[model samples]
Target: MAFFPVFWRILAALITSLLIFHRFSSAQSWDPGYTFMHQATTAPTVAFYDYIIVGGGTAGCPLAATLSQNSSVLLLERGGSPYGNANITDLAAFGAALSDLSPTSPSQRFVSEDGVVSARARVLGGGSCLNAGFYSRAGHDYVRLAGWDARLVNESYQWVEKVVAFQPPLKQWQSAVRDGLVEAGIRPYNGFTYDHLYGTKVGGTIFDRNGHRHTAADLLRYAKPSGLTVLLHAPVHQILFTSRGGTRPKAHGVIFTDANGLSHRAYLKRGSNNEVIVSSGALGSPQLLMMSGIGPIEQLQAHNITVVLDQPMVGLGMSDNPMNAVFVPSPQPVEVSLIQVVGITHNGTYIEAASGENFAGGARTQDYGMFSPRIGQLSTLPPKQRTQEAIDKAVEDMKALPQSAFVGGFILEKIMGPVSTGHLELTSRNPNDNPSVTFNYFKDPRDLQRCVDGIKIIENVIESKAFSSFRFDSLSIVTLLNMTASSPINLLPKHANASRSLEQFCKDTVMTIWHFHGGCQIARVVDRDYKVIGIDSLRVIDGSTFRNSPGTNPQATVMMLGRYMGVKLMRERHATNGPK
Candidate 1:
């Protein structure tokens, strides 16, 4: 692959083996003191900890590790570990993890009530194990809006950066995307930086120079391992609470199930400060809250779950950043890459790209899985599962693609700070099943307009001189109803039937970048300290707390929040002890 920058012949050969096999031996180096990590089946029927955190994902992993520094903590994850999973640890197989729809896969697929497809991380490292490794800090304005201690936020971000973030070496395809963004007037090329600035810039990635991913799970290395217990395949069923003489229900423990369907009860150590933290993603966190009887009275009543707290806002105000993209099938082979270069516009849009991924329908030559396509509409949907009807419809629409559409690159645009929002509701009481979530993409007129603007910019980026070499203007994918068109390398369709107004295009093709946030938001579900309102000894420290998506990607900030809040909780604990 001449597309990649020059490297040693031996190293190149090793990388090829790693990518092909989807495994890396080097990932086991951190397991020296990881004796505390185990499968949920191995856990005792009853246990006690100073803190019990649900969902050992992007935030939960780091939060548990940090809290364990001074407190005995238990981190529960519904999915298995990410270690040795080539689809997760290898950079070349970027989308393979999400594409995997197996019962044991780290990524769990879900379709919203709006018919949009997305995934949630069920693995120990969370989305960081499944996402395209792009790492950029939350913007300064976002920190100010969240009312975080700026200095501490910076410190937390740096701590995470040191463990997982890395400067990526831009390959041929990524370099072109960067040039095209500037050519299209996205302004000052900020070289390389982690700050979420407006303009084209090279941000950090979690994939290190060795082409190996280091997830938030690695943050456990900094933890006092003896004090922290991590159990995998432990899906928390419900949070247990106790009420004292008319006061709010105080969360004291939780009931979770192991892989064998056996129940286990874990309680907080006997202390008023001991707490239960929910760091599940936007979908899981709120779903868990509602299952625990802390949502709207009507919802709880309908589900037959006894209401512990009639908090109407628990599952309200959900927002997903709607994305639209054009696929460009290069006549010549392009270098394989994930998101490394980004174009951040002041007009609430983010432009990004990934190249050389093989979509099952597009490139019949290979089967990386049905979800390998970088095209948002197809890749994010549940494959032959709960939304089989929707997937069948989506695949039927994909039949319009020319063979050229399958083997190329994708240029995607995402709307930031989307004012449009929706809500999540439970379909079943089963904690393992995905809840009914409706992102209501582009519900706000302004959000739809931003999508239009973003599409126009993407069209410009494709037409720019920097991107001309990869453009195949004649190729196009026929329209899918309310679905983003798949291919138009030059952003122009030679077939008249494939053409539509930009606004209509935006409406029809809207998809998700999986940047959904805002179910359990501040001032609604949780307080400034992320403590759940109307409840005691419970907190939510995940993406669900945000009013908006923090930056180009929320993973970086999400991980930072885990560390930041963990430190804050520790400080508060120390203050209460007063120089023990």
Candidate 2:
């Protein structure tokens, strides 16, 4: 009996082994969906490589992709591969898992001296991998007003669209607010055109086809080349510059720390005039520069670190889109919200929308906005003018509403507006230390006014005829009704008051959408070419380099800047060396 049992066990074990092998072999051939190929063998330690791009993110990925086709290139990322986590491949899973996996603890979040937390992303694909996939181009007018050559900007935008494969959502949900805006006499504009200037109007949103989010990682996957090497979980500590010709300082290599907290130095290949491109996103690029002794002289001196470059602008000009959300009860108690994305340019329109069915692949129909000088010039206006314009528009639209009509639509009023300037500062000498970020949100008087303005606009929209069908009641009314019915008022707080204005509701409930940018701004840290003023072979090509945050989501603009910088670097290298 014992011998027979042993024989059966052996047969079972063999069958299990064969089954496992078969499954494993099948998985190898099945598409993994997203690909992350890391080179196993380290490159030769000699200073080599035609280009060294840092961050492997929204910007760095494309930059390395474009440059590596014809040259030896090195791409370094501070986090592990995007595919390192299976959850990352699923859009909903990524969103659900992000909160837990985020590096900063809830207690250690970057708080300004005034006590406000600024959310930042630290991962292989950086913000692009984690962002809410809203792809918008830089308004042509905005780019032109930033003093970029029109021809160059146009070319760059085209290249970016081509490489990134921007797509719009297949189905769109029309918000009750859209009808309200039109009824309130606000002109309706197609929000996401390549040639249009995006306005304050609320009618543009796009999503991918599979109902999965389309991030920059998707675009970059296609651009990956064989020679390009991506190093994950490697955080660059500092750039080591080798002085050439006694006066000219050139970059030779970078020293970085791996995930295990061990340090390693990567040198440029021999005889290769390598350039280090930093696309570490808005928060990271500035942090890296400050750590490498390239920021404000006083701050560096305070840290007992030698200032390699006394660029005070390294952390200045910090800006981000102050976002707020309004949650309205669905009129029909729907399971999902359809998002329609639009950009209102002066001369063009861009529109994208997505329904639950196609959320994975993103929006199906995409329209590109054209270059327009008027829209971009808005940033150049005096701060007072900008504030007044935003406020007046809101007020004018609101004043036209009748009180009785406003209470009829989906009534949860969430307003996001009134952006505030912020700064990114190093809290410690350690590269791993989170920076002290101060948004000073709503600190500026103008920002407060803008928030108020946004609330008023919402109120006006609620009063319009388009919303009358939904039957949106005030919070007090809903609460009273619930109380009378002996039902739990779950959505309302116990401290709620009947006298609160919609504006007050907005103030108490709004939160940041996490679109930080504009610190380490262009023309401040670097010139038109994105090269740091005093450093050679070093440049910043990420959201941090924006002179001003465009009104739309910044992913497309960030990618465009990366492509632009990459092409320029390649062009310069070719011109100087007469083509590889």
What do the candidate models score in CA lDDT, each in turn?
0.78, 0.50
Per-candidate TM-scores read: 0.87, 0.72
Cα RMSD of predicted structure 1: 6.9
Overall local distance difference test of candidate 1: 0.78
Candidate 1: pairs in clash: 22-86, 362-406, 482-508, 483-508, 483-509, 484-509
lDDT of 1 by residue, 1-580 (tens): 3321321221112121111222235533233347789999999999999999999988998899899888999999999888767777776566667756778988887878777668888898998998778999989999998999999999999999989999998988788889999999999999899999999999999998777888988888888877899999999989999997898899999999999999999999998779999999999999999999999889889989989999999889999998777655566556667789999998998999876533335333222422333222344333233254554444443444344444457788898888989999988788889998888877789988888778777778777889878765543332221123332211122233333666766765566778898889999999999999989999999999999998899999999999999999899989886532
List the candidate 1 regions with Cα displacement exceeding 4 Å. 1-33, 357-365, 369-376, 379-407, 473-498
Q: How far is candidate 2 from the true structure (C-alpha RMSD, Å)?
A: 15.7
User: Could you give candidate 2's per-residue lDDT for residues 298-378 as a string of tens digits?
Assistant: 888888776777888888766544433222321222213233433232222112212221111323110100000111111
